[model samples]
Target: MKLQKAPQAAPELVHLEALLGKASVTPLDAGCQPYLAERLEELGFIVERLPCQGVDNLIARRPGVPSLAFAGHTDVVPAGQHWQVPPFQLSELGGYLYGRGIADMKGGIAAFLVAVERALATGHELPGLMLLLTSDEEGEAEFGSRVMAQHLKTQGLLPPWVLVGEPTARSHSGDTLRVGRRGAVSGTLRLSGRAGHVAYLPPTANLLHRALALGQQLAALEWDSGAPDFPGTVLHVTGLEHGDWLDNVTPSSATLRFNLRYSHKTSKDAIDQRIRALVPGDLDFQLDWDRPCEPYFSLFGEAQPNFLTRVERAVFKGLGQFPVLSTAGGASDGRFFSALGCEVIELGLPNASIHQANERVEKGEYLRLIDIYQALLESL
Candidate 1:
């Protein structure tokens, strides 16, 4: 079979920008949810909607065998203040597209979709291709991709490979790929305390002071020196709340919530045990945690050779160098897919203004990502 030279840029990428012009806030809403669904159907793929709590997700498949899935989220992080252009509307100033989800993900989805369409038009058939769009990736994601993944598993339709289109580009917005991510464990801690007057504290330690001490101990307790794929296990006192801070009265109760970005080197139970070991024996404290997902390594012997080569070719063609292969940073939905034993890797337009005010992407980089996606499809 003859392979046609890859296009310098996907022309359809711009049309993709227009399609996602309707933006959804957190979970899926009427404005963007239905709009995305219609667009996917128009692309000639069989689509499924797995209703997620309040949000909805889209799963479109071009049927065959041993599938390759391109997964991403459509709902954007709240567009915070810091915009010279409207966050929802597209602006082409300085050759960059400024919008809420432009870089973090909307650009990713557009590029992948255009690649799929281009491959189809050029008679470049894939084993099977799927575009999985969820609305709750930036939210709790309690009911979005997790739900669809479960359904696919039950139906024996989970794809063999997954490419999560999370922007991993550093400095600029191209040439980065993330193949591994650390795990996340989050919960609240509350230590019960007895009320007492500040001036008349007698035989007991003040509840507020005890709680503060416990928090200090928890934070100071070393989690791990550091791990191979993830940074050292560390704890952050994200939220500290007290019912009262009065001068005369001691607090009766206090609560705090913290998160742990951990690695596969340790289990949640082990981390919990470490926390328990750091607390005072007299204080009554509660620890609650849920293992959202464990980290996975996708770079291995045989498969990685082909995948990485294709990825690097596209990266070099678009952004001029192999991006830094670093894993000590933000978590991704790709981490979840990797844990499920699929070959998961993420590469997309540069991540310049992700999860920040007026997230933007270089329009040129967006099209470049499409070329990369198409190249990956051909090489894979």
Candidate 2:
């Protein structure tokens, strides 16, 4: 079934479609930079560059009172082997549009630029609406919008309300407004033991076994039963290293790398305490509070009902369903925005194939997203 769009919405949408035609695959947003900057400048935005190594970030805005910011990335994960249509070339295959980043979020960058541009063209005061685009998101993200957010905050550049264009859609609902997200805490647990031949019966315990036990405990520990607007926190063990390449030699040490997507309820100190308590001594263990970031909650207790009310009404009218206020997922630049206490929410196209080849979004749904974004701009 096709999603419907009004005739008046066709023109600007064609522009979005054309931009997707230009492939902005990661590290090489190749032809995408000038096009975006030109479009924003054409719309009378004051655009600036946040220079990084090879890729660059963009900050664009139309001046207003209480500032507003929309953030998203231009980088697409490398395309794999799923091409009914060329991943770099945009095409309407079936009812969906096929292309890398169409959903994971070229769709967002396209819609907001057009909606905000249209709104500004209306000549009504918007109390300050802005948009920022970064190219380092799909990579290590060491130099993307997060860095921009920090820079903005230091210079008092943070805005009043911020929306991150992360695809937050599910089967039952068209979109969900992400009010909060669990904070990601990660660490390297190193255990040391005596190096010896496998046949040598040493009194020393196997550091590998100790590290494995520690990993099990850390993996089982619960971070939270979910925060006010988010889901139960999740802990995942990403790396386990031991048995040095020389298998027969009882390697002196083993390492485990793990991460916790913890809710705001559990602070880093508390989480660390629980971890260290589980270790058995003479095990020679090393722990790092490698929490480069902390989990954050929105101004989202019952205390901020009005804020959610405004967003729910907007989501209801915009997408025909009230957004489920949520805080589940990997960390995003939203974490940085939240630090400065911006009323943050993330919404975008259905994440059908965000970081993959032949990535695509339904043409119908893509068009509908513009209407949704337009509705949000109109309401806010």
Candidate 3:
């Protein structure tokens, strides 16, 4: 794509450019949160800097019970090699703004800020509003929104509705709004057996052979048929390892690393039980599990018509088309709010280039998002 300078700076673009100037790589706010805090404070918000284990977090709230909260992260993934423009500086090319975190998701943050400013400028009192920002979303995520959610719960400040600015749109801005996310569980399976020469080893003694057989069975196992809003539970064997380097020798042990993206229809305990049943009773094996998160939907029980209807109308008003409600993404911080019994929805710029080299968002789409968010705020 050819590089072209934008004609003029819009408020949201200017904000995004300043944010892109900050090299806030994972676990490092690099002054991004403080800059945002200053702007929010100017809007009559009480900004609190909550740092957890070196990760920067900010919770800015206007007086009153928080009815709507905008949640996002400032930290970005490492800007890898081979970019067409400097990753730390915003560049406009072919009507797209390129920079790290522009789509995942400093762009969303900037748009929301401008939207809030525009909304309040009308001299209309908005419902109780809050902003939750963290600089660790792209890192281990242990100290980001997870910790913020705890603090909110303690202070009794958790909002009834949360809008996470994760890049959920596909083809265009507001095309897809995520109502929920699938849970992710990772596992390591190690099978132990006797090592011997390939020609001399018994079939049962070759752990690699057993591992392959078990892997096939595991891959074929049906977890769940899926729900209307969520996809079916599926397993993917990510890696396989064996100690043997020589072709003639059978390794004594083998390890298989796998991950499962499960829907709410299947429980973690149920998944564990099924995996255990698939293993041969006579085999010596070890199965280890990592921290697993459960799937969550914005509509926990019955659907809340008011909240969903407002969002849909706002999206339609902004884009002239209603968005499709989906729960197909991997995971996001929105789950933190959903866990708190908050109705959470994720909507933002198109995600085609997020986290990739030359990450970018269409300049028009970025401006349009400001309108969408403003409309949503007004409707609420």
lDDT of 2 at 258: 83
Q: Evaluate residue 148 in candidate 2 and report its C-alpha lDDT on the 0 to 100 scale.
A: 82
Pick by TM-score: 2 or 3, better one: 3
**Model 3 bad stretches (over 4 Å):** 1-9, 196-202, 245-250, 291-293, 300-305
lDDT of 1 by residue, 54-102 (tens): 7777778776774689988888888778677767766666666677787
Task: Name the 10 consecutive residues with the lowest summed lDDT in model 1.
Answer: 1-10
Alpha-carbon deviation at 228 in model 3, angstroms: 1.4
Clash counts for all predictions: 2, 4, 0
Stretches off by above 4 angstroms in model 1 are 1-10, 29-44, 80-86, 171-173, 196-209, 238-257, 289-306, 356-358
Question: Per-prediction TM-score, please?
Answer: 0.83, 0.84, 0.91
For candidate 2, what is the total of clashing residue pairs?
4
Top-TM-score candidate index: 3
Q: What shift in Å separates residue 44 of candidate 1 from its native position after superposition?
A: 4.8
**How does residue 93 of candidate 2 score in lDDT?**
56
lDDT tens per residue, model 3, 167-261: 99997788899998899999999988778897887876688888998888888887786778778889999888988578888888899889999
Candidate 2 lDDT, 1-380, residue by residue in tens = 34333233466566566666676667666667678888878877778788777777888777665466888888878777856666665566566677778777787888777777667667644556777788877777777777788877786767877878888876322467777777777877787777767677453555666677778887787556874456666778889898555766667889888877777777778877877787786677788857456665678436543455666666676667777766766777787778777878787777756676667677777766666776667666
